[model samples]
Target: MSKPTLTDLNAFKAVAEQRSFRRAADLMGVSRSSLSHTVRTLERRLGTRLLHRTTRSVSLTESGERLLQRLGPLLGELDTLLEEASSHEGKLTGRLRINGSEAAIRLLLQRVVPQFLALHDAVELDLVAEGRLVDIVEQGFDAGVRLREAVPKDMIAIPIGGDLRFLAVASPGYLKGKPILETPGQLALHRCIRQRLPSGKLYRWEFQKHDQEVLADVPGAMTLDSSQLMVEAAADGLGIAYVPESYAHAYLREGKLVTVLEDWCPHIPGLHLYYPNNRHVPPSLRAFIDLLRE
Candidate 1:
């Protein structure tokens, strides 16, 4: 029997891991038909059925499972060794997959990405902007950026940005007839624009004044999933929006929105870049982290 080529092995791995020809094709940057053909050719060469394919799903056969169990770790180690060797040569060249929230992506694009890419042109960055927190390791990401409080305890985390504050803001038109919102409690009396988290739960507005902290489940007439849309809604006289200060900055500067409870909006630990502690840190990711710190 002829030996299976690296392309065939990689195609098999991608399909087996993803369990979907469509998804594997998307990740591999190849057509679904081509990926399927490659896997079939691999199976024929090995003289065994490696996968159980159905219209709706794909599962590995016993042979495929055994092969994956053996090959996965070996391939991972090989990739790591190659990355380390390249790093020693002072040439960082590899894909760095990052999962980040919208706000984190904004900060990375504005501060780190451009400079990092310029310094290491061969490195490919795949930035996935997700609204919800994801398990980076399980999702096949090299690292993730999230609010400091949201990072998992088992991961190694490094703060990538300064402290961030959340502000309660509304348009002048919406505030005209409303009573002054001097305290967080006053939010209940006004029409609020609430934010819905990725888990489909409403995010309680949080505030702090000196030693006192207030978490208000303020009632609202409108709820949105995005901070940018919330700012736009607040600017359009919808209701008060509790958003990160950066998201509302332009509106505040343009006089489209006014802030309340400034004293309570204390700065908190900001975005952090994190990865699993047990994994070998890729040189590309390490370079990016160092750039962020600088």
Candidate 2:
């Protein structure tokens, strides 16, 4: 019998699991054509067809089904062993890709990432800031940040920051002419700034008071996709902006902005560092999590 390559197995596994070459390629961070070629190469080596592919659908053949059933647990075990081995190694090295919102990255990159990189110079950090949620595994990211421990149970979640609150702030000029909004509904009467998600959808402003929880889809004079830009616009008295209170503090104190509707914006759980529960967490991610914990 001829020996098989690890790449062959990995490619085959991805194709079988996702049932589509395009999706498999997405998960592996390779082009669809490259993934298709890799799978064909594996098929040639085996001298048998493993997947039945049509224009619209792909399915595993009988042989492919048997192979997947056996390889799934084996691959899982290997991943665990790899993480365990790296944990006990003298020097750890690998690239760690983290997906998160722009605001959270800004809050952590300066103080947290530099410290981790200094200790683990062998590791490389890839931080991607996006507004919409994505399938991290399919996007070739090692981990993602969620607003709290609200991520999927299949992922291991570590709370990176403590409680956080959204601050509604505006320039003194803007507020001078507007009536103070006693309720979220009154926000409709005031000009507001809005942000868009990566999915090209606007983020709905969430508010709570007593037993009345309101999600306002308020119209805005200007629509933006960045928190920094939103804050800057609000500082110029364009409208009120909902921003993380932590980032709003400096501007509020420096007279660049004034916070309002403090009682409406209550503190909640902060950002969470999360990754697949059974994934082979590279050394860089493990170290970064530890640093975040400290």
Candidate 3:
């Protein structure tokens, strides 16, 4: 019997771990049919059925499970060793996948991304802007960007931006006839725009003054999942919107939106870049982190 090549082993491993040919193909950047063919060739060489595939799912055979148990750690170590060697060469070259929030993406696009790419032409950064928090490892991301408070305790986190605050604002037209909001409690009487969180729950408007904090369940005629949309809705006289100050900056400057209950808005910890605490830091990731710090 001919020996299975590394490519064949890798294809099998990806399929076994992902348990779905389509998902494995996406991660390997290959066509689903090609990946399936490679796995079949591998199975023939081994003279055993490695996977049981049906219309909806795939499962590994007993022999396949044993092979996975033996090969998974070895492959992980090999990848790490290769990454370490690449780091010693002093040239960063590889893909760096980052899952980030929309606010974080805005910060990167402002200057960080362009500068980093210009400096390291060999590195490719794949950034996905996600509104909802996700498990970076399960999602196959090297790192993720989120507010400091949102980062998991098991992850190593580094601040990437300064403190941020939310602003409650509305278009002049919307507020013209409504009573002015004097406190967070008075927001109940106003038509507010609310944001829907990734968990499918409405975000409660948070406020603070001195040592007192209040979470207001402000009612709204409109609810949106995007901060940009909230700002736009407020600017179009739909309702009052509580959004990140940066998102509403342009509209506020243009006199499209006016602030209300400014004293109640609380400053919060800013965005942070977080990654698994127990993994070997890839050279590409390390280089990007250094660049971000600089």
Candidate 4:
């Protein structure tokens, strides 16, 4: 059998890692049929079946698993070497996949992404913004952005933003004639725009004052998942919203909203960019981390 082309090997690896032809093809910027054909050709050259495929699922055969175990490291080293060699010319070229929530991605887009892209025009950034936290390493991402508390303990984490606060805010119209909320416990008697977490659970509003902590399961008729939406809901006089202070800044300035429990809204650790400690850092990812720090 003739030796397989590097393109074929890379295509096979993509499929193996994604475990879905549709997803792998999308990642590689190729059509599903084309990616499937390349992997089949690779298997044919090696005289072995590499994957067990059904309509809804794909799994690697034993031979395929062994091949992937050996090939993953070699290809990673090749990519690192290629990126390093390219960097000698004062340019960087590679793809970086980062998984993050909407808030974290927005922060990067505003602060880090523009500079990183300008400095390394050839680097492609695949930023996946979602509500759920994922295993970045298992999902084949180069890094992940999350709040420091949510970052996995085993990964190398770098702070990307300053401390943040979650404030209880309501429109002046909603607060008119209502009893002033002097403490978090008073939220039980007031309407609140409830927050739904990524895990499908209602978020309990947490507060801290003088080293004492309080968790309130706020009552309300409305349940929203996004902070921006909650802020809007509060502005519309639907209910009070507990959200990141940044989301309510404009409303506060315009007098559309006011914050209650000001002293109880304590600063918390902020966003972090984290990556697997054991893996080699790609040049583009390293540059991104550096830019974020700056």
Candidate 5:
């Protein structure tokens, strides 16, 4: 083609982001020489130097500054539109990427995912499930699912799941003869299964009674990063696990585990799907959201 291709804009964006051809090359999965040649080709077509280059640094020229300022967003939006169209098949077929916690995924997938896909049979979903909170914009995710407590104020949050309750539970084997903790203060004396958060801090046990809320830094015999692990540990009668009620459902039904201190645990706002306020709401995302409601 005589005209520039999308690859050209992508190369420009990569170079601009890194300010180094070598770094851009690594990011774009291309050789340094190839990146250099591509930039040279782009400059030739544009008939101006877009970058001021030195041995150790690269910055935009006057012309480059103007172009970069305007080009960056325009190109990004173009890519978004095209990708959305392709992913959604112009709202006829589509694919969606949802970044979220594993627990959140497990909680909603059974009811929401299947119905949403069935309604939009052409829509495909790729779930990025991790406990670590991710920046959806920086990571180029279409949308993110997170608890309302963690969502940023700048994003638009649509509540997808109802109120979630924390349940303090242990195996019948573990709770036998243990003094029941009727208050939040007493949890400190118990051997609780703890969750190590991404911030390198253990999750503070949270409790609510009537209109009052409490966050307790409890001592633990064992701490794990994953909720699944904590549940397994609790099932083995290792310690009392303060976990989401959803995770304890099966055990609660089978009498393997029993919930304790029900009155102390309060209902908290649940999961929500969030997206950048500045970003165009893609049809695919809308379709997926509707599925969550169903």
Candidate 6:
């Protein structure tokens, strides 16, 4: 049997890691059928079945599991060395995948992304924006961006921007006759646009002023997941919305939405870009982080 080519081995690893030909092909920028053929050719050369495939599932055979156990670390080391060599030559070339909330990603596009891309022309930065938080390492992302408080304790997190505050605001039409909301407790008297968290739980609005802090399960007639949508709903006079101030800034400036509990909302640690602390940082990711720090 001929030796397996590095490309074939890597292709197989991608399929094994993702457990779906479609996902692996998407990540590798190849057709699923082509990727399947490549993995099959590798298995044929090795004279052992690497995967068990069914209509809806894929699983590694014993031989495939053993090969992956040994190959994962070796390929990681190889990637690190390659990145280091490229960096030493004053060129950073690799793909950096980042998982983040839509709001966090919007901030990056506004401030950091343009500068980073200009400096590292060879690097491919893949930004995946979603409402849900994901396990960056397990999902094969190079890093993740989220609110600083949401980052896992085990990860190395660096703040992406200055502090942020969540403001409780409503359209002027909606608040015209409602009594002034002096405290978070008064939210009970108003209809709030409830925020549904990624984990399928309703978000309890948090407030802090001086030494007092409160978490209120604010009453609502409508629930939404995205902050942008929440702001839009508030602007439409659906109800009061508690969202990041940035999301509602345009409406606030246009005299559509007005802050209700300004004193209750306090600045908190803002969005952060985080990566696994135990792994070697890829050169592309390191460069991006350095740019953020600047």
The C-alpha lDDT values of all candidates are 0.90, 0.81, 0.88, 0.92, 0.81, 0.91
Q: Write the per-residue lDDT of candidate 6 for residues 258-284, one digit (tens) a residue.
A: 998899999999999999999999889
Per-candidate RMSD vs. true structure?
A: 2.3, 4.1, 2.6, 1.9, 4.9, 1.9
> Mind giving the per-residue lDDT tens digits that candidate 4 earns over 51-72?
9999998899999999988888
Q: Give the TM-score (vs. native) of candidate 5.
A: 0.76
| TM-score per candidate, chains pooled | 0.90, 0.75, 0.88, 0.92, 0.76, 0.92
Q: Which lDDT tens digits does candidate 2 get at residues 101-200?
A: 8776876786698888788776767888877787777555778987874577788888877789888898898999688877778888999899887788
RMSD (CA, angstroms), candidate 2: 4.1
The clash tally of candidate 2 reads: 0
Residue 70 CA displacement from its true place in model 2, Å = 6.3
Per-residue alpha-carbon lDDT of candidate 1 for residues 75-144, written as tens digits (9 for 90 to 100): 7677778888887888898789999998898889999999999999988899989898887875578899
* Residue-level error in angstroms, candidate 4, position 39: 2.2
Which ranges in model 5 have alpha carbons more than 4 Å from their true place?
A: 1-4, 11-72, 83-95, 119-124
Best by lDDT: 4
lDDT tens per residue, model 5, 1-294? 256667876787678767888878975679988887888788888888888889899887888778777776786577567766676444445457788998778766876887777777766677878888987775557789899999989999989768899899899998888878788788777898889998788899888888788898877878998767787889899998988888888988999888888999888889998988987877778777776666
Worst ten in a row by lDDT for model 5: 87-96
Report the lDDT of model 2 for residue 65.
Answer: 90
**lDDT of predicted model 2:** 0.81
lDDT of 3 by residue, 1-294 (tens): 999998999899889878999989998899999999999999999999999999999999999999988887676667667767776787777678899998897888785888889888878788889788888875557899999999999999988878999999999999998997888989889898989999999999889999999999998877899999999989999999999999999999999999999999988999999999988788778878998888
lDDT of 1: 0.90
Which portions of model 6 miss their true places by more than 4 Å?
Answer: none
Residue 121 in model 5: lDDT: 77
lDDT of 6: 0.91
